[model samples]
Target: MVDVQGTVTDGFEPVRDAFAENFARRGERGAAVALYRDGRKVVDLWAGTKDADAPGDGPSAPWERGTAQIVRSATKGVAAAVPLLLHQRGLVDLDAPVGTYWPEFKAAGKERVLVRHLLAHRAGLPALDTPLTPAEAVDGVSGPRALAAQAPAWEPGTDHGYHAQTYSWLIGELVERITGRSAGRWIAEEIAGPLGLDLWIGLPESERHRPGRISDVEPPADPAAPGLRMRPRKAVTDAYDDPASLTRRAFAAISPAADENAPAWRAAELPASAGIATAEGLARFYASLIGDVDGHRRLFAPATLTLARTEESAGPDRVLIVNTRFGLGYMLHGPASPLLGPGSFGHPGRGGSLAFADPESGISFGYVTNGMQKNVTADPRAQALVRGVARALAG
Candidate 1:
């Protein structure tokens, strides 16, 4: 049995069991799960080794409470909050054309793309025609510049698709253009700083040692293999198998993908993919979105929260090739990836990290892992934990 540590409140012990089962049965390398109810943390648990495959050790370092991991696209939820907070404060108009703030966005028949369109992934600029090198992606200016000059793959506001990597630059540039502050800086000063969370969009050199090194898990040898954890839907499989498909292009927009475990990638701000945080920190951040946490101010007012959670787009995502649902900037609960409940809103990382807030139950959850599975949506381990949470709430 994995030596799991930490505590869960009286009613939340089941969540700890589910977390332990992940290491015992689901091949979890290193991971942590945290949950908050109302304003208080109810469950905080972590287990396994930081690097299961590291050399010269009987086992890798113990997974400590302070250890964090890079939560790929799960970073989108935190990044989204920046613009949404600005909107709540009356600094941004969601319905306004993006050109109102970033004039360069007016080119390439994108003049009609509204701020909401960008948030909803309906702006039709999911991928860049010109691919960006890892260095260019890290530089910040090059990726957004390429996006500004390229035409949308589809008509603006006509259809929705997962922006994948482009969502970072699109939203990041918008935040900078409107507030004259980088999204990372704004998030640090306005959100993490106030809540006292360890989350970081642009990690500092001083804290580089805290994150666990990431390693990819191999997929099942046969695509048709039964009971495969990372099985893709038929539509998803068909789209991904085609090299020229929008789904493939959108995910590969950042060519020569940056080494996620590298110091440079962790220090640079890639709001969609490179957020580094402890599961507790991510849980606290989401908890604050729905209600005050430990006397810290709530991030979103009720009306703004409603707007952010409302379903803005739902249908076949042109890029993901799955029926994905998106709110203003969050991935909502759906058949594709049911997080906590119907009222839950959050984003999942490309591999295994998942986080969300369920206002109906007054619960917020965060899970991060260093052992990444090939699954794109809900990893089986996370799904098990959510099921445990549901069972706990039901009781």
Candidate 2:
């Protein structure tokens, strides 16, 4: 407990303790967690170092209020909202074929893929037959062009896989094709700006230099950090190591994975990943998804909210090699990525970040950390804080 800062409404002291325990017992380098109940923020706490990459444990900036970090795949939840919002406004049709918007997607036997199928991870186009280099991925045209011409691994909409990296183009191109604007610009003007959230899909240069900004993520200093999951390790490792495994190909769609800390990756908008936000912004964004935030109206209407949390896919995930559940773009509370019980829908960044909203309990939560971990989902530190929130509610 290196002096956790920020308020945690009287009942939420447990959550603050949980945040502290992450640093003390879980090898956390720097992190923040926030919570909103109904429409009000009940917790906002941060601790540990801000410059996680600073050499040799030398003196570095303290993690302070307004610290933000890239939430990796958690960007899916935010990106999912873009299409959903468009549908809500009658600009996009979920049931229609994605080719209705992006004609190029009609090639390679994918003309039948529905818009909802993309969101539900059932487009059957998870891995690229030919992978892109890191530079080619952010080059704007290569990713989408490769996906449009490549046939689905499985018949379109016949099965589901995590989509992994290909999801960037699946959704990004669709958004751009329909809105006549970059997905990043649409998000900023439509969702982030109106909601007054400090979230960004494409981070700007000014945010890069700010004090306490989560510009980079770093590995845990400790040798024995928590790993990918609680399981017999060999099986998972084999799946990841197999050259032809969906797990391998899907994750490696962009070989070597782009340097997420680099300025170029931050500037390019990749909807399936590469979104950044503070714990407060992440929590508040999800809070607004399910209900109003502060005085602003909620992003999703009641019917749209129902559609979002409704389970669209479940069972052994093709890429993850685990039982996972999804509701459109958001991950549902499930065996693989349990959140706060049923109806909790959100996404977790493979690195250390988690955010979700439980419409059933009227709770929205976020945890952002510079200490990247191997755990893809249900990260122990985040799970501990989620438990604390559940405890606070019970108390």
Q: Pick the candidate with the highest TM-score.
A: 2
Q: What is the overall TM-score of model 2 with all chains considered together? A: 0.95
| lDDT of each candidate versus the true structure | 0.85, 0.85
Model 1 misplaced regions, further than 4 Å: 56-58, 209-232
C-alpha lDDT (0 to 100) for residue 177 of candidate 1: 96
Root-mean-square deviation of every model? 2.8, 2.3
Query: In every candidate, how many clashes are there?
Result: 0, 0
Sliding window of 10 residues with minimal summed lDDT for model 2: 219-228
Tens digits of per-residue lDDT for model 2 on 1-395?
48888988998888988888888899898889999999899999988877767788578788889988888888888999988989999999999998899888899899899999999999999899899998998888999999889898888676778987888888999999999887888989988888888899898788877655664686322112135454566767777778788888888888766777788887878998788889999999999998888789999998899889999998877877777889888999986788998989999988668999999899999889888877767688888898889889999
Tens-place lDDT per residue, model 1, 1-395, is 88999998998878988999998899888899999999899999988777645668465677888778888889999999998999999999999999999999899898999999999999998888878888999797997898889899999888899998898899999999999999988999999988888899998776775344332222211122122223365766777677688877888787766677678888888888889888999999999999999988789999889977899999788886667789999999986677887889999887788999999999999999887776677778889999999989987
